[model samples]
Target: MSQLRLWGHWPLFLFLSGWCAVAIFLDYLYAGIPGRKYFLLLSGLSALLLGLSFPPFGFTPLIFFGFVPLFYIQEIADRNKTSELFYVYNAFVLWNIFDTYWVANAALLPGIVAIWLNSFFMLVPWIGAQWVGRKIPSLRWWSFASFWVVFEWIHHNWEISWPWLTLGNAWSSLTSWIQWYEYTGVFGGTLWTLIMNILFFQFILNLKKQLSIRKNSRTITLILCFLIFPVLISILIDRNFLAEGKYGEICVVQPNYEPHYEKFAVPEMEQITRLGRLAEINLTKDTRFILFPETCIGDIGGPVNSARVQDDNRIITFYDFIESHFNIPIVMGLTTIKFLRDGELDSPFKRTNQAFKEPYEIANSAVILKNRLEKNIPVYNKSRLVPGAEIFPYRRLLPFLSPLVDKLGGTVAGLATQKERTVFEAGNLVIAPVICYESIYGNYMRGYIKNGAQAIFIMTNDGWWDDTPGYKQHMAFSKLRAIEFRKPVIRSANTGISCFIDARGNLGKSLGYNVHSSINQGVTFSPYLSFYAKFGDLLAYLALLFATFFVILRLFRYFF
Candidate 1:
């Protein structure tokens, strides 16, 4: 009986032994492969750590050392004369895919291409760093840091601008710890992350070389001090930051219109009726301004020119409804166009008809109005467009490729944008109507504040991504704007999370996601300009200057 039982379990024992042998053999194989397994592992680790630093996971502290694995790979590749570009690209692709995969929830192919394209742009800085490192090994780290910051700054200013993964945004959720953004903007946080990661990477390299324990201990102390001091300064500043003077009473309504399902398909009057009901419910005697989300009026487009806009039926009916219900100021987002005659369309952004008809320019814009208006209202067209979706990347420079770009679902002729920022007046208060996607930009916000905009009224349609962290992250990023500019924020999302954020980046009376509701809140505005608002990304400018200086120095050394 004992012999029979032993035979019965022999198969299980053999299976377990075979699995262990394969595992051991794989480890041996990895050991034999120079930098292959380690590079792949480092890439995976870097992606996971960086992904966790953003929203949903929001392990904000991980960002401080998230680049360690990639930096380590770069250093080793530099020393070995191996191809670092391949490994860098792999790491960046993984990071972009993991961090922004939610973008595929709307359009699958576009999202995949976006990830790859974003990864390609990320490689530009790494390539420069590698070349500089080969030329000046001692100053490689400094060059790399400067190059990364310069890349980030350039990323924000370009036509294909997608600054979603900008390193400083990691601290957005931790508002209390970055109150000093009023001075440095988000670029300061980016600088801090890079410095810490470099120091940590160097410490590890020193350890591998069998450095003294005392010296390593000093490095550890230095790294901790560098990390902790910023938080301490931010806290001190946050404690002292204050706001005074009431701007006015504002009523923000979230109509909960589903963008894909019913927002466009519903009858125009029905959409207005729903919005009117929400406004009626929330409208108070003290309400001075009523705010609505972007594109709330449904499938309506007209000339952005004030004289022609007044003649459009959509604008006429909207004004009629507002005047009948309330006699206060109103702000909303809409689609508008500008007609161009035969020779009037000068820019490539203006589209012409194939039948030799006239051309016109379309735009996504926000407008402000009151009950007793005679002239055209102040309309601000959205400038910071969503790449691929809202605007074709470099359409003007490569107009011949417009057909291919259109097939890929990008706008062939992008929305027309104004060269300057516009501010709308509500009695004594000036309101900046920041549309969807524009709110994420820090320097852009400062432009409005500098133009005498007292308070920010962000009108957005968050239903595009539903109730995921996509919308939540967007709402949280607005806090950075509030802190940087010292302006009260009144955000009205088409599908809820409508709320009020004070100058200190504090959330107050927020509606739940996907809910149809409105909130009546008292907003205060300050004419006070924060340091960031006055100077406008001075840190980014300094980083760009440093990067230029280093590049010139490398070129000069190579030639002379």
Candidate 2:
């Protein structure tokens, strides 16, 4: 009887013992550290506040002060002569989990790797700032700001890039306050965020030390000026800004196929026919172009040959439908394979077929097709691929990891990409054909405008992470691009959120998630480029130079 009773209460006993073990471990971890509770509290608070500041939760005002708690945690570490790694890593991991937990809905293993790896990368700048502060305390805050911008800039340019959490992106939805993005781009918002956080942190320190009223008031005044001045300037600019140019009507179709199940499993013609039906419902005689979502072609069948894409049965049907009814151009996304002949230019991304011994490369590409008479078709291969899903970063250095990369949804040799941003001309309209993952790159998009793109058209499939903030956040990020380039944006998604964004970052006629729909809207195209489009990320470049100088100075001091 006694043994039966003890076994019956095993669950309670296990819970009690596990809780005690965690408590003891935490106590040991912070043994010599003072204000242990405060440190832990600030870490959790930092993660919570920052995570809440992102989309789906969207507490935008909280972002201005979110990093204050992290700064406090750093101070505690410095004062106690303790390593801040564990605390900072925990905070970052928690923030990543809270904001991007939806990423696991696509793939379990790759999602975990993305979250953990991104967290580690985020820690680099913080740790570097800490080290620089120890070497030269007077330049501490400057180093922190400059190092962070440099990190974000590197993240945009590198192969292992993931700029989804860039601090400037926090204002993606609040475009009214960031109209200055046309002049400064998203990096300006990042600098604004960092400066505000630093000022608020200094005010907090003054309060802690019971500083004089005059000093506290001065800091408070500076914070208010920094916060209010930007908004006022942005308001004035938005009120005065006008989108001037030729107006053209475009039809965007959202054929809501479930990516994991219906998109690939269904036949190619069936999907094309559905897209045709949606386009027919919304397309008018004045419609200049019809846009389809990414990978709408070549999902059921294998990738079509780039040289003979028009020969595919699905393409024949789509082209016939457009030529018969509308006689207009259609820009759509597809996968294409290109074979290389002997003595041709070579690339490391090439793959060899075991059966025929032929060299070829596969690309996630967007192509614009007109009537059969049009011989030259324009195709732009996506250059910015998702790190694990579409590419294996540093493949030349780590050939041993090719098998692992293959398992993570990438090809063994990685996908091929084009060198230049291609613009497609349909009648009098010239637009940039931006693929799924390319819209988030502000600086990269500038190349299209410089190459004579008047408007931006993005084709994407956001259904992989179904019914999550991933799709919403992706849609929100496009607004930043529209503001930066001062160009109208037309987006077509496979599952939902297809709409038109104006030059001022305003949405017009949006379709919701999981809805099969289409929208016909007239958008104005600007011939003139914005300041940011003309000069790309100047602030980030300056920050990189400053960060490099600081590091060189620190090294000289250490050696001397």
Candidate 3:
């Protein structure tokens, strides 16, 4: 009976995965076709495919199946050199790969990202060159390399972008090459994989008599593959799950606070106790650090801003009592009270957003209350805010109209946004904090590490979108950061999918929603940094410049 049910689910699973790939393939064809009908289908499939990769199916494994159709499409389009069909085909391939990276939550996948298997994602240009190669044989190789490198560059730069498939991901896939990640960034693996694919494909093409080119293409293929193969194999062999590190006690409390509650709505005593209880499970004498999800303990506004507010001095006073009891610092999320004018008080974000005239700054932020301290210590305001909830996008066009668009109340009327990705220093630890959606912004996340962040800690409230593909995709991006920056990540979510990711993408110490309430895993600095960190997205910038040069230069040549 159980086997039958399992088989039953597999049918739908296979169907959805296959259908999504087919839909994407057709979407690609539509771009080559005149009407753009397939583009609509393409967008729809992109959305659907992204949705499928999440929870309902850890079918994250199935995402690669997309490569098959895309592969054939590129192969078929390249059949004739004169066919304009080749251009659209190249564009479509770029889009599909972009969609995959998008579905994977680009910047979020933890540790070294494994999606590098999608390294072909970067080879569309070489495939494009097969057509241009026939027409202008001299420019074939350069064109192809330029084409792919350009697309990748544009893909990573547009709209604060998603550059998850850097060649470096292939190294991440197999743990061994990953140690070198500190030096390469994910792009190193990406470059190696693309070169391998090109060599292998060329080697196979040349295996024939007439079609074969008797050139260094053969020797070059051998040498490149030989040099890269050992590195790839060594990565696998060196992947010793055997590294010794010190253990520092860390505690995480997911207060599971719902947004609807008033500032003092829940008994601060009760809510704090609830977290205290969950936290109680890991109360050790050596706890070096502790955490709570974003704004988990209270409502949007607290005592400092509220006067007649019934939920007075409760949350702060309650924490005052509890914090006084423990000597270790407790890092938590809460709404704060900041008075505005001389005699009167108003929302802290009132100046930038007049509609949200309420006085309390309902910031989704982190606060560290040192054990035995009299008051809450330094507060870290979340620099990144979600599109709809905390912030209203494209607000300049519709200013006064935003506050009225809210279904839930008490968020200080309007909204607040952070102008920068700032770092918080606690003791000897220089921590770069990413709160929620900010994690998805790779370049933005880079700013923190560039400012000297030894380690990264991301606080998220995944509870808003739970049980769906949304959560899983969000978590996967966390892995990408570990690989890109080669830093240890400590992720604490409100609901589930909380885990500690090392620089190499190795997951350490996690708590699933079904089994445990919170996780308090210790984090250590890897002392390693990535070229990406030292140089920033220079490769991506170069790609973008290349794309612009070709796009503008080519368009001008064709038109003028």
**What C-alpha lDDT does candidate 1 achieve relative to the native structure?**
0.78
The number of residue pairs in model 1 that clash at the backbone is 0
TM-scores of the models, in the order given: 0.89, 0.93, 0.65
> lDDT-based ranking, best first?
2, 1, 3
| Candidate No. with top TM-score | 2
Cα lDDT tens digits for candidate 1, 121-192: 988887787778778877777787888888889888987788888888888778888888899888888888
Q: Candidate 3, residue 167: CA error in Å?
A: 8.0
Decoy 3 TM-score against native: 0.65
Candidate 1 runs further than 4 Å off:
1-33, 298-306, 324-326, 341-343, 352-358
* lDDT of the structure predicted as candidate 3: 0.51
Report residue 518 deviation for candidate 1 (angstroms).
Answer: 1.1
Please provide, for model 2 over 151-265, each residue's C-alpha lDDT reduced to its tens digit, 9 standing for 90 to 100: 9999999988988889898898688999999988889989898999899999999999999988699899999999999999999999999889899899999999877767887
The per-residue C-alpha lDDT of model 1 at residue 184 equals 89
Query: In model 2, where is the ten-residue run with the lowest total lDDT?
Result: 1-10
lDDT of each: 0.78, 0.83, 0.51
